[model samples]
Target: MNKKYLFIFTIVIVIFAAFFLLTKKPQQKNTDILINGKKLQVELMQTEEEKTKGLSDRKNLCSNCGLLFVYNQEGFYSFWMRKMYFDIDILWINKDRVVDITYDAKKPEVDEFESPRTIYQNKVPADKVLEVNAGWVEKNGIKVGETIVFK
Candidate 1:
């Protein structure tokens, strides 16, 4: 009788283990950015903290790399060069479409530190924001109203 009970316990444990394995979440896939036949390996920022920190403090932004910000809703968003080490081009995107672009956004000046920081606002409401190396937009021939595909 004890042997039968032990066997039953072992089967139950096996079933529970198998169920847990089947219900486990899948690993996330790496995402890439594409625009006008140009591409960049990107780092996605979906959380408020990630968006706030942004590309600030980074010494340089690679020509083939970018920061992609995703928001929960479409709204008029503003960006600033606060704590940023270099300039970058900002693309305001909504529904994977380019809504506005801010070119060559400069870093905050030391003098401005004591005063109000300059804010770069998107011309239109956007749900996503992409920051790339300065002049990337012109070099790639990306234009307004063009759709940006994400993979």
Candidate 2:
């Protein structure tokens, strides 16, 4: 009888361990960015796959956490809430250390990820864009016309 009870307990423990391993949350990626005089360590999404998967599953972002999008040239750029689980403030920058636009993008409440039909335009052409947690700009006093230096 003791042997039978021990066998059952071992099986149950094995099952629980398997379940825990399979259900473990994915690890977050990290990257470094510099804005103004401050250095920000943030999660990176450099590839197309990573960009598409940006902040979709995350429930929270640490203070000053953000995603930076690098483009080849200065041009008109747009972003939407597609697959995004959180709101962000988008800062558009030109190559000449000029901040052309700032956008406060709200995350979609619905599950379907769709791009906004009309692009949120920028005042100046942008070569790079930085998307940070919502209100991060206001909280950090990050403003337009301030230059972001990449280190």
Candidate 3:
């Protein structure tokens, strides 16, 4: 092989190795939640970091994977595409565990979609919010008045 070609091959191999070593698999923690007496095994996003990173950059979500957000007070809440890479369905819940509303959140794109100078709106009022893969709620037939218990 020519010396120049050999050097290029070596550089490519080094770059590939660096990329493989620098990328880490995301850690998924588990928690249990009950919906109308039916238990669901879900991944927990309890910490500030985890909550902030909620579903962002994830190429896919497991069938039952979800993020549960616990708020200090009940009010109209909204979420934005922000840094998200995939679309999600937001399930808004009140203190009584009743499903009050559902919103289809937009998927994040490569370009910035949020307006920097304006306040964005939330789709529903809620004390607690559950985010799942887009269409999960409809596919599972989850509806208003359904109750959720976190365990």
Ranking by TM-score: 1, 2, 3
TM-score of each: 0.78, 0.66, 0.63
lDDT of all the models against the reference?
0.86, 0.72, 0.69
Q: Between which residue pairs do clashes occur in model 3?
A: 76-125, 78-122
Per-model RMSD to reference: 4.8, 8.8, 10.9
True lDDT of residue 3, candidate 1: 100
- Candidate 2, 9-31: lDDT as tens digits: 99999999999999999776666
Of the two candidates 1 and 3, the one with more favorable lDDT, higher being better, is 1
Candidate 2's TM-score reads 0.66
Of candidates 3 and 2, the better by lDDT: 2
Evaluated at residue 115, the lDDT of candidate 3 is 30
List model 3 lDDT by residue over 65-138, tens digit each.
77777677778755556656667777777864655545466674556644322223444566777788788777
